[model samples]
Target: MIGRIRGMFILGLCSASALAAGTGYQPPFHPDQLKGPPAGRPNEVLVLGSPHLSGMPDTFAPAQLEPLLERLAAWKPEAIAVEAVSGLQCDYMRRNPARYADSVSSYCVDTGPAQAATGLDVPAANAEAERLLAQWPATPSAAQRRRLAAVWLAAGERNSAVVQWLRLPAEQRIAADGMTDALVAFLDKRLQRRDESVLVAATLAARLGLERVWAVDDHTADSPTPKEVEKAAADAITKAWDNPYSKARAAADIPLYANVAQPDGLLAIYRAYNAPESAMQTYRSDFGAALVEPSPQAFGRNYVGYWETRNLRMVANIRDVVGQTPGMRLLAIVGASHKPYYEAYLNLMHDVQLVDAEDVLR
Candidate 1:
């Protein structure tokens, strides 16, 4: 709670002025003040804001993430969530290409082969994956793990599939239990990519002996915009972002990204990214700037709306996972740009106790 605010049970309506600055009215109640079921342990969530690994410099090596990973491993999160669209959402978007065609191409994996191998589409595969895990043994054989991987892949949860693949013994990584040869090859190749979900989240899950990583990212807010409107929105936002704060952020990031492969370099970058001041810096540079851009169509408002909607849905997806099990510990890995919004919005939940990212990184 170093930088977080706890809800106040008392409303200060009696004495002092709670008057307006612009349109000020302090609410009568705080949901966070309402708290839990009054029984079991409260849910703890640690949101780790990560730089998208796919955007790292050419010199970036997966091994460089070790120090950062070690600290998170010590945290011992029971459930891990990553910033990737769930296969279920991807399937819905795929059907309506008029709106989400581009998003699908950018965010979703092609699960056709795995679907064919498992004879299950995204929903069916997700169901089967749940069924198998419901009856999953305390100690499963290699074939069981392999089948789970195949099933997860078909479910559009490739990162979770990677977790299953890593858990299997080296010799046990074969096509068995509905795992086709082509699917195994696909998993092997995809496993080698430098995605944070793979190298960090899934890797940590495997080390912790967890069954799978959660895909809690969302793009359902996306809708097709006309070409002309897209250009106008992009230009307006770009102009807003040309501020001193944005420039300063770029200046700091250049050095951090440059030194990431050096000893303990990755740790420094994460510390800087997770600092409390960084959130304000983000607002000043990005969202805050965009909020005031005087676009005729209110394009700035549209962009901000899309961003908030997307984050809200993503957090809801996470809430779904943590809700199923009381007192669960969840670690969410998302882009640094998303950190502030995630923490601020999640703070409103009654049962949630937000863990300081700074403390965890420390």
Candidate 2:
């Protein structure tokens, strides 16, 4: 039976032209191919898979990240994208709280203080940020950076605000321009957060002389489960995760997280996470198990569907920026689980070339 199924799949590939003749359902083109002979510059994307620093083992020192940061700095990415939802999306979600209340509460920065300070709401502040950046000077004044930082904060993008703030010299990072004392305090607080978005992406961007980091994470796929099915869905999925593959997954990763404070331990952690087999392991453990879940409500399939939908939208957001400026070296930092999906989806872009994460880490 397996041999027969494999033969049928092979025949489907050979039957691509059959679809044009209206005789088969096979797809005619694979987007992963069709790379051009020449372009101004290929859009090279290097995705770094990372553990959430906020959840790292207690032994993990924030200073231990310096070596990893230095290595990535050497890659010279022109643009950096972090796993964060944009302010615009958050603003929209906030207005429709019935569907997004949980997401807003969990992932979004409360921009109220910054909005009051700037007298601009989310959309206005985000637009003003774009306008200022459009013609940002070769050498901006300290006040200019401070003002941009304020605008970014009002837009619900604290990481980008941190980028702007960090670019300024310590003495100049003061309450001027639109930066009120409270807003300044907000950004100062962000610098101390151990989350990957701040500790890694924002810090790296500032060191690389970039003015702003991009927030491309999506929570639009997130919605409260219907009350009727919520508990059953949760129980079913939890049971599915209590499997052998999942146990092995934890076994392999627990040690990696524990030793990150040691010399070269981070590089080891990265290489293991970015290994070619890591994606398959994720499938065998998480999504794949969820997919085959036998619940009558099809809870596992729903879980898998959500995962794919989230990754699809996340990749689409990344593509939006990659399309705007072709031929630039871009870096995307995301959770380890998202790396494979990001790469698979990005490879479908006609112009994007995926740089091996292992190579970058090496």
Candidate 3:
């Protein structure tokens, strides 16, 4: 079906409604309209670009995102995908404990402790977290809040812990997952990290009573970079960002994040990001940057290969989800870098319609 806009551009009801009615409009008809029947069913998809919250400096406050998250919740997405890899966060921690050793030790209070304390695996803990959020007491006792926090932490969802904690009154946000002052401080600090976006997704899902957030990010396409090639590639990527277009865009974008609390600040940035031109920015910043490689080195090709492969796989994951549930409205929340790639790849799928995120974000 051809997509239709609604409840917008309400300039004059008589003319606008008459034109939108499609009877009196009769605007230039395409020859293809007569040439063919419709294709597959359309599934709405929105790819939202967000800055990696973990990378935000100390000045970046988590509270500023509440309004934006509230706005997105209004979209009433049936399915939501996030940048995190699917499965328990501890799976990654178990496989590469060193990678997350610091964060886990700091915030994930005594790994597996919650599972041991509650005998609940990740899925089970997630279920409990949902139940607790849904049935949260009007004025929860200290013990009750601690139980919810422990379950959330056990799920390796410190982000969700922060989310639930933020839902509490300031006086009630004490250390509850094992209840140490150090853990309380660390939990607040975790809220500042990259997982803040995950927190937003989790909070929205909870508000909508969604069972789980889908993880569609693909990292299998990433090849191990040789040290020599890595150094050169890093420099090339840096220079690409230094290019005039990149510089100007960065200058414009930084202010949006800096002033995110102001009205329409985040929406303006989201609108700019989802515009058609933003795809070219991704091309230049990512795939095109590798073109700077000198002759005889295919390093740039490797970069493009990795980028395209990752995006294709990610889109495949999304398509699989949509295929299972026809007419599903999906929202994929991902890093700013991935937004264009996701839209470009998902748009080609016959059944998937890339919803204009500008329309939704606005």
Candidate 4:
């Protein structure tokens, strides 16, 4: 579904925006907002955390992703690192061939192959990556194809032999049909859980020609009942939307479906829907209960805490990594809630450039 041609078109529009901004009209932010990375740093890192777009049709759309991708490309980062595991990066590269090689790094906060290295322990990223790779055809280059084979091989002599065999020409390597079919089956199972975040991340990585994309998340051993948690969270979110206050706010704001005009309008909606303190306590209560029931709130103390920690960690991780890579600019396409947090975090970093979501959204 993700094609190179479509990615190029998106990149072109982003180029135009970068050129237009040359005339420089600076905006002001509160002191609190002005906290995080230092000012004027050449290396730009964008951390975006989006909500599940499929479920929140009124809040987000897939088309909006194009601009975000273009903007990040315009920044011309040395590499575009994503919140995806290395396995997914390999699969995406194999399926979607590009002209140039770009470097991408993923921080795994889960228990996976890279757990000992990053100590992040995020396996979902790896699982998702494997699924994506299986869905796509192997790349044309024999060397590249061999590299992929190496990843799948276990740590032993037999694995090394398989890697050597794959290095041979098309005729030499074992029939790829069997491996290809098995990969497809693996992808089918992975796609069953429709998490839009991985899709958005993968789509952006493929479009940007990023060499590698990193997956960041902590792995959990226990299989928490995600379905029950999701149901509870959904119920809470729906209730808040239907509440009297929420309805009043929605009514006060004209053109319910129109793009939010002022940042305040967007913020007001976010607060009503997800603020830490509000009349509709059921949303928070259910969210907390769901967290506790599943995994003792390891992800967050409450829903708000979860959102805050994830957003802050992303900002922190970007700052930590982008500084090391000279020209790498990151654009994170995250949820609306993360926008406010990023706006505040980036302002604190002295050298880092802050692009307002409102400016881009408009």
Candidate 5:
């Protein structure tokens, strides 16, 4: 599944700060304060992939990324690669931070720095790029020139179209830019017409196969404490099972919960009973209780175990790809949830070099 890039420019703008913050930002733990990865392993390239935090409407907000970006930047990576394909667009955003905001706001409803300049919705770094681009008349500004140079370096001049354009005479270059803009517009139109879910799923499949994309389970997979188990059981029986208002209580195991009369009826009751606020409160309460055990050993064991399994699988996939085409870079686009674990595991591998997300944003 080849994924069509949508809002590539917007994503470039949105992720600049988050990516920059991830690189060069200091962390709570000093380098000497922590132990390094195990000895005797080939170095591997690893990058923590994350969605555009700012553009999403509700599930995850951009503001929540502040600390996360800071932590990631402090780790310092060799390079950062984003999902963006257009070097020109990224350059524009980086130069004109304000214009980046306008462009983003124009594309995404209720988002971008134009809405709120500070806090979580702070303008993207690409806005700076655009601003810089605006300053140059018929010629690229110093920053724009640097960006073009960086793009050329990253993409390589051997067979790159951008490099080809650079080789053209100055007068011909204007024509090349117009052609690039036309191609971008054509692609953007195609993307805008696609189903968003399908686009997202296809993107993931192209980057990481189904087997490589595992559902992250942050909660404890083991059985709860005796007291907690008893409480859950009691709750299941009383609040969920025996309540007169509960219609689906008896049909909880039915496969057709959404279709069956009893089960479907009970689902409606549950939905009505559990308002968003109420559900949030209940979830918080349960989460608080679960954290009381304070078992770092258990937590670390579970965490490391999952990561080890994932890393082995990823290594196998990387090996297969390398066997077919040596020296090819494998880009993985994954949710933010998997970033930390993947980053840590990849750091331990000798065959891989993690790309700094900051470098990509810049």
Candidate 6:
């Protein structure tokens, strides 16, 4: 367990003299004084709060994320998780293309052309892709790289496609899957969203010489609400966000946005938001507001319930991905709103050590 807090547990016995000496003073307490569940295998987790790059304003530039990516690559996590539906691209799309076709078509590379180009269906292409990746040598030939790119493209893994393209010789890489020129160019132009979790996670994984990225987001907890209830909930949430406290928080983010072009500047903002106090703020502004609503309909409470359930399921998914591997460090890239919830739920897991994102970001 690399990041586990190793120390002897010692009880701090209260002394009568110390109590008698001071009226309002308390004896010092240590973390080891508290009793907790039995220690298990330690899995270090760092949850990175990220803005959805796809929806960035017109002023945002892809170049802004380069230094940040470089800093993250230095951390060298064994596993990476992004805010995406697990199996949506490689597994679900292959098995139920009709169901996920529209989504994949809209957000990622079109599977139809890729399948046609590779001469294999999505599932078959994914299977072959796994085999190729498993059997890939330290120095794969140009032909093998091309095949890897084709297979990843067929599986709707555009980021992996870009990775394999970067591995290929200049002559071997082509405009296949609309990947213009080379990987960097394609990411800068075709993707147009450098801050995307899949793009950032996959690229970092590749840079760290890892095989795959994990998707741990779950939406099944979303509750179906009647039109009237949904409207009320939305209105309540909107009102909460419009309050002076929320407005001040939003205003404070302006500096962070302005510094997105610099790694150190961005890291400062990240470290600040990743603090435990920031989590408390989120809990108060989000969950507390929901609980305080006076309506008997419990409209706000329903939304809060859905949110908590979603985070719980997401944490479960992360555990499943980590499996029984001890001392494994996992980096999770998620929306800012989900960061606190993820940290809270992960800390409760017996085998997990929720590492502060600030430590790594620094």
In model 3, pairs of residues that clash are 54-193, 54-194
| Cα lDDT, model 6, residue 82 | 82
The list of candidate 6 runs beyond 4 A from truth reads 1-42, 55-59, 89-110, 119-122, 169-171, 175-190, 222-229
Better of 2 and 3 by lDDT: 2
Q: In each prediction, how many residue pairs overlap at the backbone (N, C-alpha, C within less than 3 A)? A: 0, 0, 2, 50, 38, 0
TM-score of 5: 0.27
- Span of ten consecutive residues with least summed lDDT in model 4: 1-10
Residue 174 local lDDT, model 5? 35
lDDT of 2 by residue, 1-362 (tens): 11101111111222222215446576889878887643688889999998878887778777888878988999999899999999999999898888778779878989988898899899999999999999999999898999999999999888999999889998887888889888888788888888888888999999998988899988777766666666676778788888998899899988787788789887788889899999998888888887777876666666666677778889998888888887778899999989989999999988888898777777
Q: Write the per-residue lDDT of candidate 3 for residues 227-276, one digit (tens) a residue.
A: 45555655544554466666767777787777666665655666677777
Name the runs in model 5 displaced over 4 angstroms: 1-48, 52-55, 58-316, 319-324
Model 4 error, position 173 (Å): 15
Order of the predicted models by TM-score, top scorer first: 1, 2, 6, 3, 4, 5
Give me the runs in candidate 3 sitting further than 4 Å from their true place: 1-42, 55-60, 88-111, 118-196, 239-242
What tens-digit string does per-residue lDDT give for candidate 6 at 194-240?
45654577767767877566667764432224444555556665554
Q: Rate the local accuracy (lDDT) of all candidates.
A: 0.84, 0.83, 0.62, 0.39, 0.32, 0.62
Model 5 residue 245 CA deviation in Å: 37
Question: In order, what is each prediction's RMSD in angstroms?
Answer: 7.2, 7.3, 13.3, 16.4, 21.7, 11.4
Model 1 pairs in collision? none
Between candidates 1 and 4, the one scoring higher on lDDT is 1
